[model samples]
Target: MSLLETLAGKGLRREPPTRDEALALLATSDDDLLDVVAAAGRVRRHWFGRRVKLNYLVNLKSGLCPEDCTYCSQRLGSKADILTYTWLKPGEAADAAAAGMAAGAKRVCLVASGRGPTDRDVRRVADTIAAIKERGDVEICACLGLLRDGQGERLRDAGAHAYNHNLNTSEAQYGDICTTHDFGDRADTVRRSRDAGLSPCSGLIAGMGETDGDLVDVAFALRELDVDSVPVNFLIPFEGTPLAGQWALTPQRCLRILAMVRFVCPDVEVRLSGGREIHLRSLQPLALHIVNSIFLGDYLTSEGQAGQADLDMIADAGFEVEGADVPTLPEHRREAAPARDAAPLADAVPVPDAAPVSGARADLVAVRRRGAGTELPPNA
Candidate 1:
């Protein structure tokens, strides 16, 4: 049998490929790589077809993190000039969800920084989620740091459908990136969220100086955990962050990583998360072949491709955005577009009763939530 067929046949049950084997695939010529990617694309098509799931992030809080995670601009003792603020009022978060819905996003993520949420934080987020749900349709995914024992239940009750706590990297390489907490802590949160009945959305960051073995380990770990959604982020080096100016990743390398993850975890929602523009750039269109979803609009502490541009890209690639198949603006808000340069940065204080405060960093810090209601940090 052909190598591609053999690889596809083994599927997720296939033994993890060795570093040399992965490198051999990575080293394939562009023509050969495309052929491999084409095979992988079939797997993607079989499950997701031409429909693209677009997610928008609402950084409900920004900056003021206590953890010393090396890669974050919001970590303690860092000098990155980002905005910081507290949680948004419930009304505002809901309005943001409406904006996301108007922008054609299938899901709107509510992300916060710091060490989980206190009971108070949970209630506040829960209320916001309830309000968002009242409006209808858009899926709500909450990222409130490390989840507490019952906080996931509270969120589920509040109408949150998913929880996002990225593993960031493989277990073996996690320590090198952040010393404040162990990889197990992140895993536990996912488990807790699952037990609470919320869909567990977890993922990793590539190009953080990890080995192919490390990548394989992370891919298998996600598969073992049965993650409902996997967001594969490429590290976007920020000034004052530990990994700032570390390494540059090529588009082909990024595609290979995406293809590898798709081959390993065939059924999961392999999303193209942060760093798609800078690393993938012109090649972003091709990534959709292997990845079933992507983040629409902006990301935490970073600008992303404009919503209209994303719509154009989807059409150009022969794929359809979830809500708008023909590429035209929605009927109700044809003239209304998300402000081109209006990404908001707000400080995210932990909701009380979330997770224990590890010496590292709080789950989230200074980040931005697009839509309505802007909560600026003390200095901002």
Candidate 2:
């Protein structure tokens, strides 16, 4: 068997590749790329098998971020125009969860923008989490900026099954993306979430101008941190962000990154996060050969492949979405009827606490002109 196959068979942690070895794999030929993915698929099938976990993300608070993350559309210093809003009330959050469940999502993620969650923010999120859980059958994940003391525990008590705080990039490359926070701080949050009995979901962004060495470092870091879930994001450049024009990803490169993550973190729930449609495009089903999970519905501040299209892609690829039997609301919860609005930028607002997100959060707003360049059909 080849080195890649051996690694996949033995499991990720058992014979993890060295940096040099990982580089060699990155330089692999296109003909071998599918083989690499197939090998990783064997490992994935061994653990998960055609079981694709679909997650839905609700941007509880739209823009209003305090940090200056270079890759985000909602960072403090961004010039890209994006929406601005505060935290939604508990009822509104719950309603979104119900919609997600109806849409066949196994979990609903509550994401807010800011440097970190304050005491009030945590309490409110916890309450909303409780309400969502009470509605039944869906897992809850929180992606607030950072975790404060005891906040992870409170989230768990309130029925949060997982907490997502992505490291975004390698330690060396992290400072280049966001100076407001350190890589260590992100690691600490993941550790605290794990300690608090919440499954930690973390991952990195590929095509962020990082080196192959940087990617290897991130994979190793995720393994070292014992993260339960890893999200591999491709950088989707926005016109007003610092890295606005930096779109260096092709489908092959994206597939390689997913395969690499699977090789390094075999048992973890490797997810295909943002930029999949833009970067992977028609090859999205191939991504499932490596990643066992995906973000369904929508992403924060960006458009994703349509839900039905994603389902079609998965079926076409010979895989099935997990938890298709889960019940969900027929229509998504919305604050108001859909209307035309300019897309919101990353640095638009400086973290405002809106209102309880439960029943009062407005209907899901569609950012006009945001989906223009991507391959996804309009209105998806």
Candidate 3:
């Protein structure tokens, strides 16, 4: 069988791809890219159909973070000329959320920039969650960095449906990106989220100078964790961060990364998050076949594509926006019936050889001048 055929078959069966198979998907030639996507698209359809879940971000706090994650525009000591502000009041955050929901976003992610949330910060987010709930029905996901002993439960009690803390990259290379925290800390938080009855939303970022092996390692790790949502982010390479001008991803590379994640975590919600606009560029419509979810507009400190443009892209790509009433997970992973015959852990496999990556467009990264924490009207 062809590599794509083999991987697609494994994905449909919910079998974890061997490390070699995952790396091979990343090394496939650009000429074979569409076939790879078509194969993974089959798995995406089996689980998610043609529905694209729209998620919106409301940056409750921006900049002044203590953790120095190398790729983040908001990381401490970074000169990235992005917005920096204190937490948004509950009413202000509610207003921001209403706009995204009006544009058909089903989930509102409340994010803050910090090492982690303090007890008071968690309470503040609870109030913001309450205010956003008052506006209309929307799934609430809090992305405050790291969780203390009981913070996840507190967020859940306040009506949070999910919590996001990205593994960002492989454990082997985790320290290279940030040292204030470690990979074990991230895994612990995901465990905390799941134990607290909040849907675990963890994922990774690409184009941060990681090798193909690193990407595969993280994808398989997330699979083992069984996180409900896997957000695949491309590094934005903002002009001021330590990774400034680091452009390691091309459109094809981005697609391949998304395809590899799909094959590794076939049944989960694979979301095309940050940096899609710059790296994926015009090929984003193609990615709809791979990822079932996307951020609607504006990342924490950078501008994304226009919100209306996102809707148009979904339509043009022949996918429907997943409604708020629709469940994001397959029936087996849903909260109502959580039990399942857990698949046996795949055997340890050696990392495959690294794949060749191509050039990136340095001109594409744009700092956020509007949206939350700004005077200009926020994009939906």
Candidate 4:
């Protein structure tokens, strides 16, 4: 069988790809990139069909992180001027989640940035999760840095459905990104979350100056760890961070990475997380064919396409939003487009829940602006 055929067979069986098989997907020639994506799409369809899960991020706490993850704008000793605040109050967190739910998101990710949450911090997030649960039927995922002993059970009891901790790169490449924590520390957390009966949502960040071999290693590792969700984040290379000048990604390359993750993980939820807009550009809709989930609006510290546009994107791609009917765009509204050469989606809060409207929204103007690259930080 061809590599793609063999990989698809393994994916159909929900079998993990061997390291060699995973590496071959990454080594695919640029000329054959689309073929790889199409093969991966077959596997994606087998698992998720045409349904796309929309997730919304609630930045419960921002900045003030002590770890020096070089690609992050919020790391210690960095000078990025993103928002900095203590944890949001429980009601505020619920309100943010409500905004996402209004935009058709099925899951609310509550994220905080730090080494790990204290016992008290875990309770606070649990309270926020409880409040959000009280309001809607949304699944709650917590992205506090690391979970100490018993913290996962506390979160699960508080109504959290999952916990997110990303293995942002391979074991060989971990030190190049963050020295404050080791890769084994991340693996341990995933294990703890699973033991506590919480779904493990872990993923990786690409284009951090790592070799293709490193990418394959991480994909297979995620399979070995058996995480429930895998978020594939492209590096934003935010200015003022250590990796600011590393512009090594192209749209086609990003697609190849997503396809590789899909073939390796098979039935797991592969999310087109964080750097989708900036990195994927016009090909954003095509990514939906290979990955089953995307954040609904602005990321924790960065911005994204308007929620309406995201909804439209899902509809335009002929994919239905999971758990809700996709809203149809009126003919006149279809003619309206974001301002040409508009600003990047940053700093602006996502649209709050509002009444249904006809045509493109008059307030939905896109202008080109500069600052932090748009991103969705892993729930931590």
Candidate 5:
């Protein structure tokens, strides 16, 4: 049987892909890339049909992180001038979350940047969680760095439906990305979240100068962790971060990575996160075939296509948003919406070289224009 056939069969059998099989999927030639996506699509449709889940991110707290994660603009000793802030008031968080909920997001991701949440931080977030839950049926997923002992349970009590702690990369490559913490620290958090009755939502970031083996390691690790949601972020390579100049992702490679994650963790919700616009460019629609979930609007530090554009993309691609029917594109959106990157440079969010993001918290109102011209070859 062809590899695709075997993979499709494995999906039907609810069997996970082996290490060799996953590597082969990643190694798929550029010419045969669409074929792999098609096979992964088959698996996706079998489990999720043409329904896409819309997720929205509420950056409850931004920047000022103590950890030194190389890819994160929020990390310590970083020069990216992204917004920094202390915790938002519960009402503010609820309001931010309401924007996403109104946009047809079925789940809202509440993210804060820090090494871990203290008891006070957890309680503060828990209050926000409770307020958001009180507002509607949206699922609450908290991405507040690491959780202290019992903090997950407290979050559960506060109405957090899921917990997000991305493994970021493989155990072997963990040190390259951030040395303040290790891979085991992340894994243990996933376990803690799962143990506390929050659905474990973990994932990885591709194109961070890791080997193919590192990608495979994370895919299999997610399976072992049995996470409910997997977000595959293509590294943004923000201009001021340590990885700033590392623009090694292509749309095809990004798709292949999503397909591999699907094959390895067939049933989980694989989301195309972060660098989709800068990296995926025109091919974003093709990704819907392999991933069931996506962030609806702006990402934590970067901007995404407007929510309407995302809804239109899902509808145009013949997929329905999870909680709402496919919306009809008005005449303006009917012809492709303007590429987010085409926006003027002044509109782009700049990760400034500064102290804690806390300094720029008030500048959140300064919207970055999503412009074009950032793509470079993997070697560039």
Candidate 6:
């Protein structure tokens, strides 16, 4: 069988891909990109069908972060010219979340920037979660940096359904991206959230000047974590952050990364997270075939396409916006957690980066100018 066939068959059975198989998929040529997407699409459709789950970001707090993770525009000591603000009042946050739910967001991701939340911070966010839950049937996912021992349980008790702390890159290449916390710190948080009965939602960022092996390593690690969702983010390379001018991904490469994530963790909600508008560009529609979830409207530090445009694209691409009542995962996955075995990354094989994307439009790396912190209407 072809490599695609081998991996897709395994994915259909909810089997994890070997690290070498994942590396080979990443190494597939631009000429075979469509075939690779087609193969991954088979697995996507099997578990998710034609449904696209929409999640919205509510930047409960913005900027002024203590950690110096290089890719972020919000990190300390940076001059990204992005919006900076403290916690939004619970009513203000609920109002912001209501704007997105009106536009068909099934979940509202409540995000705050910091090393971790204090007990006071947790209570504040829990209050916001209660306020949002009062509004309707929306799911609340908290991304409040790392968690203390009881914060996950506290959020879970407050009607939060999931917790997001992305394993942003591979364990091997993690220090290259951020050093305030190590890979173990991230993995431990995911485990704590899972133990707290909050669905684990973690993922990775591509185009951070990582090698192909580094990308493969990220996918396998997420599988081992057995997360309920995998958000594949393309690096936005904000001009003021350390990754400024790092426009290394083509639309084809973005699709390959999504496909690889799908093959590695087939049953999870593989989301086309931040930077889809910039990196995927005209190819965004094709990505829908590989991913079942996406953020609606604006991201935390940047803006996505208009909400109506996102809806129109889903219709144009022959898919439906997955309903709020619909569960994102397969019945088996939602019924019970499965055991996950780690797949070790092969250190001997290092694949070079793809050639630089010519005419990578720097204009697409826009700073968020409105919504949460501004008087303007939220994008959704």
Local accuracy by lDDT, each model: 0.72, 0.75, 0.82, 0.78, 0.78, 0.82
Residue by residue across 159-201, what tens digits does model 2's lDDT show? Answer: 6777999988889888898889899999999998888877788
Residue-level lDDT tens digits of model 6 in 1-380? 29999999999999988899999998899899999989999999999999998888888788999998998988888777687889988987887777676667788899999999999999999899878867776878899988888888878878788899999998999898787889999999999989888889999999888998989888888888889999999887776788777778889889999999999999999999988987788899999999999998778877777777787788899998777556777999878853222121111111112212111112212324522222221222
Every model's TM-score: 0.82, 0.85, 0.89, 0.86, 0.86, 0.89
Number of colliding residue pairs in model 4: 8
lDDT of 5 at 228: 78
Candidate 4 stretches greater than 4 Å from native: 324-380
Task: Write out the backbone clash pairs for model 4.
Answer: 143-379, 333-359, 333-360, 342-367, 342-368, 343-367, 343-368, 343-369
Give me candidate 1's TM-score against the actual structure.
0.82
The TM-score, computed over Cα atoms with residue i paired to residue i, of candidate 2 is: 0.85
Clashes of 5: 13
| Runs with alpha carbons beyond 4 Å of true place in candidate 1 | 11-24, 27-31, 323-380
Winner on TM-score between 1 and 6 is 6
lDDT of 5 by residue, 45-106 (tens): 88788888878788888778889999887788877756677778888887776666656677
Q: Quote the RMSD, in angstroms, for model 4.
A: 10.3
Q: lDDT by residue for model 3 over 1-380, one digit each (tens)? A: 38888899999998878999999989999899889889999999999999999888888888899998998878889887776889889987887777676667788899999989999999999999889877776788899988999898888888788899999999999999999999999999988888877888999999888999999999988988889999999887777778876777889988999999999999999999988887888899999999999998777777778776787888888998887656778887775523222221121111112211111001112223522222321121
Candidate 2 Cα misplacement greater than 4 A, ranges: 12-14, 324-363, 366-380
